[model samples]
Target chain A: MNILMAVLLLGGLALAAGIVLAVASRVFHVEGDPMMERIDAVLPQTQCGQCGYPGCKPYATAVASGEADVNKCVPGGERAMLAIADLMGVPPKEVEEEAAPPMLAYIREDECIGCTLCIKACPVDAIIGAPKQYHTVVESHCTGCTLCVEPCPVDCIDMLSKPEVLEEWTWSAPGKASLVKLEGDSDARVA
Target chain B: MPGLLERLGGLFGGGVDLRSLISPGGFPGGVHPAQMKITAASPIVQSPLPPQLILPLKQHIGQICIPIVEVGDHVLRGQKVARSQGYVSAPVHAPTSGTVLAIEEHAVPHPSGMGRQCMIIEPDGLDEADQSMPSLCDYLDEDPAIIRERIRLSGIVGLGGAVFPTFIKMLRDQRHPIETVILNGVECEPFLTCDHRVMLEHGDSVVRGLNVIMHAVAAKGGIIAIEDNKPDAVDAMREAIARAGFEANIEVRVLPTRYPQGGEKQLIQAVTGRQVPAGKLPLHIGVICQNVGTAKAIHDAVCMGKPLTERVVTISGDAVPHPANICARIGTPMPFLLAQCGLRDLSGVRLIHGGPMMGERLPRMNVPMVKSTNGILAMRAESLYSENAQEEPCIRCGHCVEVCPVGLVPNELAWHCRNDQFDRGQEYDLFDCIECGCCSYVCPSHIPLVHYFRYAKGQVAHIEKERAFAELSKARSEARDNRLAREQAERAARRSKVRKSGAAEAAADASDDTEAGTSGAESGEKAS
Candidate 1:
């Protein structure tokens, strides 16, 4: 009789807790892709589509659902991958490729065939051209995605490394990398 | 060198710690490195023009000037070759009569060692002057706007190593009233005595320029602040102030010797006892500071009808045989000046443009000196501190925090910067750092703290620029998509309207034919 009373009391308490949880979930039901939005915010927003998805948003959605790895953005490189890894609380995978220098798309105006195909391929709308007219790339806005380079029939587009201006120059990190050293062969690490 | 008591006597010839009487609540944190002023007593010598002068258009920190004179055009001495593009920029002038050789990319005196577009000129050696703007000897009665315009046209910049355009600082504004104009004669950088020599030699010109500057800004009081290390300069400047007959409004005050005491903010705090708020200019705190060299340049511009084509440069270092203060023309090559100072070997010598503390280490000797080049240090590799030791990890010793003049936590900022955690760095007021290298000088671990801070600042700026471009690209792509969608919708609407009208016409035709057929059938039946 005592065991029966204890079972009944425990069952009633469990039922009350379950009911509160159900009601709280119903009241605080959230819609839409909050996780996807957060992942997208961490992206570089180059929209190069190198990650097998359509754009940064679609790639972010796939990552949010665990369908895609975050290490595929070439334009964003390791910086974006590490940012996503930190946000998602996952162990970061080592980036296989070396980090490339920043680049900008340049157009050879003389070689351009006035096809306007490359202009349509640009995701940033950085190219300015009309049909049967010479096209030029707005160097500042071009993300150097190489998308425009592939679509050009005449192959007028070139991805060139951007030069470091005086205003953009920064001092190098300390330690063995510094150029102002005496012995010059101090590359041995302590660890 | 003078004894302690003699130096302590200062401008009064008999006083102790006079700085307290002048400034109350002096600045908080500072470091005292050795003052290696070996060439302070050397007289100024005028240097001849080099064979060629490479004039970079953007010497000051603003928009690069646009070439007003074409290539191969002969320009007179002190004539404008490049015009100022914006209000914050200063123009480039011909240091001597010369013909433009080429406007092409060449290495400049910058830390990056990158090439910039510089106008090369082959001097004719005639040194003919361009007497276009007449001298305003009686500048006190002249309109302030005219004086300000003359300063702008003369291509004057801050000679205190900042190289900011001077005309912009003299703009009269009523909102932030400038009460005191301080002529900064504090040559506190180690091994740099260009300002010291200028104060001792051209005190009258400095005072006269101060009077003109005060008149332009409408400031009531003018104070020329000097360090106690240079007692002779103090006496010279004081004598000049009395001779000018403006002793009531203008005075000379001596300060204690300390590293970075000549910084624009530090000098203001030492003279006015008011801290310039973080991220604000000295002008915001009702004070305007000008370098002594800049004051003399202003005097030459207004009273003598001259443009800033030359300045005194101190050539001193261990590698140099004769260290002297030479008044060199702008655009003179570094090699030429070093040769003038008896420098024979340059295989292992580190050529630094400015003082040892904050100068840029030049990689090559192809670059030419600009308006802001005050000292050319050619030290042996053994003299540099970084050369002798390797940087170790920070032990959290808290020495950097103790010496930071701006009161920033260098160790924490450096840690955040090393990890690329710039958001955390901003939370610690990273932008308020003046980059004075005090913390780096005092760190026991030999950590390059200033270099890390510079890297972090550059990264922050680059990130901001990238974010701006991303925003712009997003906006552009969205607009394009909306435009395409709108055009497609308009075409669909037109096509549907046309189809509906065509269908209605067909139905009307069918009804008319049926009516006609029924009428004919009735007629036929009646006839039968």
Candidate 2:
């Protein structure tokens, strides 16, 4: 009889603790992880689909869900890959492919047929044109994605390397050996 | 009614002792190196114009000017060769009558040692002046807006090495009315005595310029703050004030010599005893400070109708046998000035564009001296102390923290910067660092603490720019997608509505055909 009483009391205590836990979980339910958004924040948002995904957001979601590899973003290159890997707490892997140097798409406006295909092809709306109107790329917003280059039927679009302006120039990282080759006689210490 | 008591007590006068005013009430941290006022006693000498003058379009801190004169065009002295692009920009004037040689890239005096667009001119023998700039001789009675316009048109910028356009600083803020205008004669930087000579030679003009600035800002009181190390400058300035018969409104106050006491914020604190809040201007605290050199420039612009074509520069160092303060024209090459100061051999000397403390190392002697170039220092190899020493580890001695005028922890900031943790450096108030070099001077470890801070600041600014671009692109892409989706939805809705109307019309026709067939069948049955 004593054994039966002890067993009943212990079972009753366990049942009560389970009920409290269930109610507490419902009462304090959080909106849960925003891991995909965090991953998207690290992305360069080029939306070029070089990663085999439709856009940066879809790729971020795939990486967050472990459905995609982190090294597939070509435009983001190694920097974005490392950042994503760090966010996911995984070892960084080598990029699957190399990317071209930074470039911006320029349209030969005179040769453009004004079909507006490149405008529709640009994911960032960097190109602005209407049907039967010449299109020009707004260079500031152009992510150097090269998405609008292939859609031009007349072969008017050319991907040109971004020009260096004095305002955008910056000092390189301190103590890092710079690989900038000197041109002409522009030696720093002429004296 | 200005008095020593009123000047020491600041805008709000109180029965305060001058001793307490000089103590814990002034600017926070500072260091006193050797007061190398070696050329203070030398009279100003005029420098001959070089054969070619290279004027950089972007000498000031604001917008770069656009060249208005084309190559091969003749430009007269003080001619506006480059027009100011924006309200904050200063126009570049021809230092002397010359023909434009080329508009091409040339090396500029920057820490990066990079090339920028410069307008090269070959000066003719005649120094013909452009007298179009109107002189507001009665500037004291003129409207402040008109005076500001004259200042802008004359292309006058801060001659204190800041090179900020003076007109922008004079723009009045209705919320914080300026009370006191402090004339900063504190040439605290070692080896720089251009301001010292400017005060000694042109003290009356400086006083007159202070009056014009006072009129421009509509401030009642003006105090000329000079370092105590230059007693002659103070006496000269006082005599100038008395000669102008403005002694009742202007006072000359002597401050204890300290490095960077001439910094705009530090001078404000030292003179006014008010700490300008972080990320705020001295104007916010009802005070505006102008360098005494800038004041004299303003006087020249307003009274003499002169654009800023030349300035006083000090040429000093061990490399030169005779170090003298020379009145040099803008766009004069460094080598020419150094040669003028008896520096012929450039074999073993390092040339600095400004003072040794805050100046940058010139990559080449071909770079021209801009309007703000105050001192050209050619220190020999022995004078460069601890610059090439291998950086040692921080001992946490906190000496850098003790000397930082902004009171930022330089050691930790340097550590974060060295470790590539810029955000951590920013959390320790990295932007507050004025790049004063005080921390580097005091560092026992020989760490270039200021270099790290500058590198981190540049990196942080670049990263911020990239992040901003990314955000802009992301927003644009998202907006484009939403626009396309909305257009598609509207197109589909319109097509669906048309299809629905066609289906209704077909249904109506089918009903009519059925009714006719039923009527025909009924007639056939009746006939049968």
Candidate 3:
């Protein structure tokens, strides 16, 4: 009789917990694409597809589905990787080091290869022109993705580094100026 | 005496800056370093023009100036070389009669290494000035619009290191009416006394300029507040004010001498006994503040129609043989100015523009002086470096918090910034920090708190730019998606319409059976 009573009490508690969880799920249910969207918002949205997926959204969906690695996003760098890791509750993987200066694909307009092949390959369609006309890439819109170059017939496309502008300049990080060198400090992490 | 916790509680205790009790009614946290007015007694002298004047197009804040004259075109003294684009910008002018050598990029006198487009004028030794002058308007009865236009055309900007366009700043905010005009005579920066000298030598211009500024802003009256340390300047300014016949309207208030008493917020507070809330301007508090030099420029601009081509710059420091006040032309190269001042053989001396607290270290001496450059300092190398210096951890001693004029805890803000937690720093009022360097100067741990704050500000600005870029990219991508969807929908509709017509023609052919199937085939295809 004592064994039966213990089993029945434990079973009852388990049944109650299940019912409450079901009700909570029903009442506080989130709609579609939330996890994907959360991941996508953290992405740099270069849409360069260096992450094997067609675009940032597909990559985000793959990430949400636990299929793609967050570290595959080369353009997003370490910040995006860390953000994705935090969202996935997984350890952040090391991001591949990019060249110091970012490169953008430039088309040599003088070379008479107006084959519209690159236009089809560009994920964002940053290049603009008719079939036989000279095409030019909008530098601002170009995600510096190299996908379009693989389809160019004349091989006129060359990847060139982005130029530095005063508007985009950022100050260097502050160097610590104290001599005391206290082992323990502010920001609340253990020494 | 209140304990540290109690003082902190008072500071963080709601929005009231209780540190206002520093003086009877003064803002909190000001450090009075040595008053180093080394060149106060030096009389103002006009420096001979250098071989060429390199006038940077971006002398003021806002839109950079567009060059009006071509490279080979000759320009007259005071001739407008570069025209400002918008309301918030000011133009550049030729300092003396010269031929335009070249409008090319050159290093500007700023912390950044970025070059700006400068109009290099090869001075023609004649020193021919712009003899064409506008009739002086009686500013007392002159239309405010005409005066504002004249000030704008004169390319007048705040010369007290904050180079804001004077005309734009003078405009009274609709929410805050102009009640008083405070001519900032409180040259509180250490080692800089150009303002004081101007008040002494050109006292009449200073007072008359104040009257014109007051007229432009439509303020009731004006006040020229000076630090009591310059009794000679105070007396001279008072007599000048009396001579200008604005004795009834403009009063000279000598505030207790303190560092940054000349700061716009502090000066306004010193004169009016009111604290301008964080992120708010003096205009928000129904007061318009103008630098003393700016008022004098306004006087020159409106009365003489002469552009702001020259200014009285204090060339003082231990490295200079003669630390005299020289009336230097705008865009005159720093080397020429130094040569005129008899500069010492500089091996490791650091060239600092403006005051030590807020001034920028000159990257190269070729960087020409703009309107905002008030002082040219050459700190001896011995004083700048300390061997075996290393960064130490913050002790949370709260000395920085105690001295913060903006009532922000610099140590915590620095910590947040260092840890890459900018949002937390913003929560603690990071943007309100005036970057006065008081906290860094007063830090017991010797932490470069101001550097950290500046880094954080730059990081915040970069993040804001990223956010804006993301917003633009998002909008563009969404627009592209919409365009693709609309095109796809239109193509589908056309296909469906063609398919429906083909089906109708086939049915008609079937109804007609074998009568003219072959002949109708081509016609049916064409119709579809």
> CA lDDT of each candidate?
0.84, 0.84, 0.80
Candidate 2: residue B278 lDDT (0-100)? 90
When 2 and 3 are scored with DockQ, the better candidate is 2
Query: Individual DockQ of the candidates?
Result: 0.23, 0.25, 0.15
Clashing pairs in 2: none
Model 2 stretches astray by more than 4 angstroms = A1-34, A69-101, A108-117, A128-135, A152-156, A178-191, B1-23, B344-349, B380-387, B490-528
Candidate 3 — which residues are off by over 4 angstroms? Answer: A1-32, A97-100, A176-191, B1-21, B131-133, B172-174, B385-389, B485-528
Ranking by DockQ: 2, 1, 3
Candidate 3 lDDT, B1-528, residue by residue in tens: 345545765667554444343665676678887988989998999988888788999988899999989988877888888899977899888899989999888877876656778888999888787767584667667888888888888889899998999888777456778989999999988899999888898889888888888877888889998889999988998898777788888998988877767889988877888999877778888898888888888888887788899998998888888888889999888778877877634555667889888886665556788899999997666665222245688887777877777678788899898887888999988888887888877777778777787788888897777556555555666566777789777666755665666577777766743434444464455334
The TM-score that candidate 3 achieves is 0.87
Docking class of 2: acceptable
Clashes of 2: 0
Writing each residue's lDDT as its tens digit, candidate 2 over B1-528 gives 235746765644465433332346477678899877789999999998788888999889889999999999999998899998877899989999989999999977665557799999999979999888778888878989998988888889999999999998897778989899999999889999999999999999999999999899889999999999999999999999999999889999999998889999999988888989999998999999999999998999899999898999999987888999999888888878888877766766767778877887664566788988999888876677633677788998777776788878899898899887887998999998998889988888888888788888888887788778878888987898899889777666755655565467567775545545554465445333
TM-score of each: 0.87, 0.84, 0.87
Report the Cα interface RMSD of each model, rounded to 1 decimal.
8.9, 4.7, 13.9
lDDT of 1 by residue, B1-528 (tens): 235535665755564443332224466577888888999999999998888898988899899999999899999998999999977899998999989999988878887667788999999999999999799999989999999999999999999999999999997888888999999999888999999999989989999999999999999999999989999999999899999998999989999888778888888888888999987887898899999999999999999999999999999999899999999889888878888898855766778889988887776666788898999998887877766867788898777776777778999999998888989999988898888889889888888888888888888888888778777776776676777689667666755654565466557775545544554465445333
